[model samples]
Target: MSDEQGFSPRERRASFTLAGIFGMRMLGLFMIMPVFALYGQDLIGFSPLWVGIVIGVYGLTQAILQIPVGWLSDRIGRKPVIYAGLALFALGSVVAALSDSVYGVAIGRVLQGSGAIAGAILALAADITREENRTKAMAIIGVCIGISFAIAMVLGPVLAAFIGLSGVFWTTALLALVGILMVRFMLPEQAHRGQIRDVTAAPELFGRLLKDRQLLRLDFGIMLLHLTLTAVFVAFPLTLLDAGLVAEHHWWLYLPTLLLSFVLIVPFLILGARRNMNKQLFQASILVMMAALLLMAAGQGQLWLLALAMMLYFTAFNFMEASLPAFLSMLAPAGAKGTAMGIYSTSQFFGAFLGGVLGGLLYQQLGGGGVFVLVAVCMAFWFWLATGMTNVSKVRSHILSIGVNIENKDQREQLLQRLMALPGVHEALIIPEEGAAYLKVDGNIFELDQARRLINL
Candidate 1:
């Protein structure tokens, strides 16, 4: 049960568990994208604006609670929080399925967003897998998303055509329930790291994250990326339908386009990782995405042109999706991986919310071209911010959470200073209240035994 990258038995199993959970969750989302807007208009009191807001409401809820949920998972353990989120999401899906009005659907979507367990899921995966193997876990999740998006695009319109929007929501609810079952049966029960339990306040959790410029840039990039994605989907289907492509045949466009993008993305990611070309790949992908958006805006009323633009856009989109997390891993401070990811995930959801709300408004007024133009502008801003980031190699880092028993403030300070001075220690935070210190160190340069010897734990 080892991976190609040489994961141990536990790591391999955990990666598979994460892949399943992420895939199921994304399927619930992707199921809505292709037809939600058009079919949703038939729901009572459905305005174009309300439809867009409903589309994005989940992201808003997810954005607001992602950090808090991750923090809670750190304190209370991952599985319980995850189960709560899943139950909430399932409730939301059922509610949306039965709702007859846009407002009701909106409420359900927000609840669905509440079930977004990204932070908890990632932290749990991090707890189980070693740093060297973390990327593989992330990669498996990434592949699941890619697959889910492709399948969803293919299924969404057909399902909507046959059974309507309510059926889609019902199916989504079923998939979410299946995810809960998988978690119960497949995932291992692991203990939370007892260290770092004292720094539980929200302000303190996010305070350290606010200081890093590079991480902030990545956070901004994720927000804009999702925002652009949501915005484009808002208009793409209608535009295609206007160009004479039926909703049922939409998969004809998505399937090939997604496959092509995947082919392009994998090579680019390998090149970026091996050659340390992440910055270059990131910059180029953003530019490509911008061009694609502008092209879509200008190519309105022409189906072939729109398809070409979509091909270009998704190629860049897939590449960036795979690359950004890798970049975040490189730039984030060593000991606060969960904290750093919390902020990143929160921003992403916020961006998704904004994109849906704003895209819907723009479409109702200025139409498809306007939506594309707005997305392009967002990408331009992200590009400017990312260009200034320092180039970071794909070196692996570790967070060592060790228990401590210091009797006095002076003793704690002395221990903190000594740990910080260690040759490969990049950063260390000692919390006397928690009786533990979080250390970030280069795995290649530091020995785990050295810390054990220092603490004699």
Candidate 2:
């Protein structure tokens, strides 16, 4: 992605620093997911439903506050909002760590979610990176997220075994403080209004984005994915326990399953993407995932079989986590990607919230096996929707900074049409206010020089 000059040193600093910050925050959050179901039962007002509530409560607050916090960053600046969020996060961690009751823990989680800073972090990434290298920067942040999630899976168990859940919460609070230090000392102070349409949500654009069928499909897919994952975890930890895996040794199973799953995921993603078998592999993963869930349910007491099924489920889950965003960026209207993602993320969080409620309910009424069966049935419906999604041919985003804002509405519209007419530019949007043109390009056929000439960049 380098020209005569590659990503500026400052841009490199921004991406990596933000990624580290994001990962630290996510690591703390995810570490809770694996152990909560088991240890939470020790709380004063313990119940399966409250267990699920504590697990999923953060999602509800995160979904509600994420966009609004992003909007706040546009007014008060990124680091300020980021600092405030981290403070809130630390406070919540302390509250949870001190709480003996499940209700108190849930309240603490809600406070933690209120410190939603993902949008602000992304918006800051956009502020610092060049338009052309934006995707690379975003990809770095995304890769960090996946890595954090994997590490947390292992670390959560190890930490829980040594330190009680309160100790884990205290550790998260420390992580939040680390994030604040990184922001204050490591991150550069260069945030502006950051009116980046493709990296920050636009309230006006929400309506059209919501109505787009393709975008909705991706949204639905992400929502269901999170829902099933949260729901499964509600009972999965207990299932392993019932099957003779102690809470302390749970990491033994997770460590191997996660590692083995990673071994297959890269090749699977590469082969699928390269062969244009994305949709086929996507649907196949869904079916395999459904089967895996059922197998786990039926094979509960059989540890080895349960492990195999868990591995299969993770392979599918990891693949989709990578694929869905790519598909969304490909499907999103150029310049509207940010808003689309906001809605998509909200759907994801809301799904997690729903998962907790549903998982707890199903587990209470029908037990662990029923949770798997019912979730599989939900996935069957997801598969039907997947079959109808707009076939996602691979593409990537590029933006040309014309460096001169064109305020004329008619002229901007004409320029948009002209850019769209360019060969291999699958989608184009001209933002007159920003003096840039956002485009989704098929690199194989797109000629950069031709578009550069048209924009006189």
Candidate 3:
């Protein structure tokens, strides 16, 4: 058995496959940011409000479809749904590229968002990796997204300037086409275990996941996080335009800022890991994000002040985006991890939609400052929730499958008691319906050989 918590060697390779799949998909989405707004404004029926609508339309579709798509992936297969989503995304990109009207662009964005590849990709990742090593797989995918976003933000404008907005859409279409090739050629067509959800299991699955307080909190956190992000970007580009900078040159601000934020992100993550300061680090980042929004609201028209505000904003954004999933892994129940993640991701996309609509309204009425104010209020609430979170101590755990002579409650309890008495055993949870046990233990005390012996492996 591997010492790593979330993946075995074969699973690690699969993890990279899913991560690359997700990265390429997100790159298509990110490539639109720098060019869409300015070029879109020139189109018929396009206004700042419509630009925000176009930007968020995909998320609205994505939010609505994520859970169903995930549930579908669990049933039919991962690759099939993934292929369908990518094809839709590419088709939508082509539609948007050919459209001369903003309404058409919005329609295309809705179609693009219908792809909703994230849920399927994540479910596949979970299916491939061992439970102990699942977090690492998710982390790898998350980091790939962050890197892709940072790079794409810089490249979007440069590419847009060279080829124009339609060209950007065509480029996104080409990327999606390439992603389809990768899926068809490179990825293994493994029939993922646990991909299907029984209709009979649906009631219990939803009920248990909904009642989970820890999962709820993480879900809320994700919602708020993405809400703040979408809301900020709704106004951020406009703020740049208002400050005497054209859209193409907006990269001048984003490129260096993203690089610096990336540099800062590594250190905080290292500190959080080494010092067991994950809780503290997580809370601090939320607080910092809140402060940045407030600072943006207060800075208003001053160019230098806005620059500083953005520095804090991206710094906090990068840190929290990386850390939140790690936090969820620590908090999520083992048996329901996939469901928990699915719910969390769904909430994130929903928040993106809400943020866009709300931010657009606020910007239309009160301009950039209003957008900042709205985000600040949202962050303030997040800060309040975060401060109450219990600090968690990391423990080594593995999901173990074993055949047990589970005759009755007493027999199962006795077996659990016996397992608890073993060296290094920390916590043991076994779900009969799921046919698995998750054990937390002292890594050094429980050798794989010993564990196998204890479980009659």
Candidate 4:
């Protein structure tokens, strides 16, 4: 059953199982987003501000714990950390389901965020997949997450109408439990442990990564993007209600917009990747998002206008979400990709949290228009920063195994010098400790067979 590309049964099993589990966990987190602003009114002590807190508190906790949890996985084994995190998530879900007060729900959300297992899951994906195929494996997980978010948006209101908010929380708890079981029985066990260069974060490299300007710009961009997203969701449900679309029928709008956005984003993604037009496309997407925010601000409760804005918003959102990570992968230092990603992810979650709090305050003080204006202003700043970003070359990351016995410094330096001389190798780093040589290479010019023989020798 192996594919022509040579993915073995174990790798495929690990990829699919981990992707499914990640998708399920994300579905639970997102299902409440579309309905929360409106339905939160039913809880005692509910206010726009507290509701925003309940909706966003998870991000704050996730921001606080994501790196530490990933670091924990490195020490305790991937499966063990995953199990514990999922268990915490399930417990939080139950707590949320039983809550009748906004404060209680917010507490549950904090606990849910505390479970943060994204780093651990990614580390495991890297562990099971070979370096050449790692990107594809990661892409599989990314696709699963995007699809889950779309489905969750469509299903959130429908589920809320049928079973109430509590029901949704209970369902999320069940999903987490299912994820726990998947981890235990379905995911392939790894025979090796410790940080994988492309996956787990390195504490020692944090200082260097923090000082990297290009990486910082990308990090800032993600922070603003998620900030805009969380802020919009803080007020968007009310916008729908104001436009006469009842809660139950909201999915009708979400489904069509999501589908259309997916269709629209594909072309841009292709053009960006194939043409090395990511910098241009990335800035363009930000501009499009700003335009969408402006439209929402001016839509005046018209359903048609709001729908159009949503479509535009999702199109830009999907594009940026896909492109940013690609850019990060390309720009990160060879051995510190994991640390770079960890910092990037933390900025993203913190942005979500800040957006929730600030978006809520803005909505409370100045209404929906205020929220849109805030997002638009932030996006405008992002657009300015994005214009200065260095264009990433169209290249792929490849890793070559250095036999464990080749530990001599002189040998490694000699090997690195030889690798650098190879045609199409943009950058090469030989890590003696990891026993691997990481390279950035142009596929069109790189001689894979030649490189393979040299490494094998």
Looking at model 1, residue 281 earns an lDDT score of: 85
How high is the CA lDDT of each candidate model? 0.79, 0.87, 0.75, 0.87
Candidate order (TM-score):
4, 2, 3, 1
Kindly report which residue stretches of model 3 are placed more than 4 angstroms away from their true locations once superposed. Answer: 1-13, 127-134, 196-203, 395-397, 403-417, 422-435, 440-449
lDDT, candidate 2, at 68:
88
Please provide, for model 4 over 1-457, each residue's C-alpha lDDT reduced to its tens digit, 9 standing for 90 to 100: 6664667888888998999999998898888889888887889998778857777779998999999999888888889888988899899999999999988888888888888999999989988887667888899999999999999998889899999999999999999999999988998778555767677788898999999999999999999998888889889999889989998899999999999999999899888778888899999999999999999999958999999999999999999998889899888876678888999999998998988898888989989988998789999999999988988886667777788536688888888888888999888887677777878787779887788777777
For candidate 2, the 10 contiguous residues with the lowest summed lDDT are: 1-10
What residue runs in model 2 are displaced by over 4 Å at the alpha carbon?
A: 1-5, 405-414
Off by over 4 Å in 4: 1-4
Writing each residue's lDDT as its tens digit, candidate 3 over 107-126 gives 88888889987877877776
- Residues 1-457 of candidate 2: C-alpha lDDT, one tens digit per residue: 3463468888898899999999988888788888998888779988778777888889999999988888888888898999999999999999999999998898888888889999999999988887667888899999999899899888998999899899999999999999999999998888465567777898989999989998999999999999998899888998999999999899998888888888888887888788888888888889989999999889978999889999999888998999899888888887888899999999999989999889988988888899999999988999999988766776767778866536677777777888889889888887766777889888778887798888773
Query: Candidate 4, 197: how far from true, in Å?
Result: 1.5
**Ten-residue stretch with the least lDDT total in model 4:** 191-200
Whole-model lDDT for model 1 versus the true structure? 0.79
TM-score for each model: 0.87, 0.96, 0.88, 0.97
In terms of TM-score, the best-performing candidate is 4
Model 3: worst 10 consecutive residues (lDDT sum): 194-203
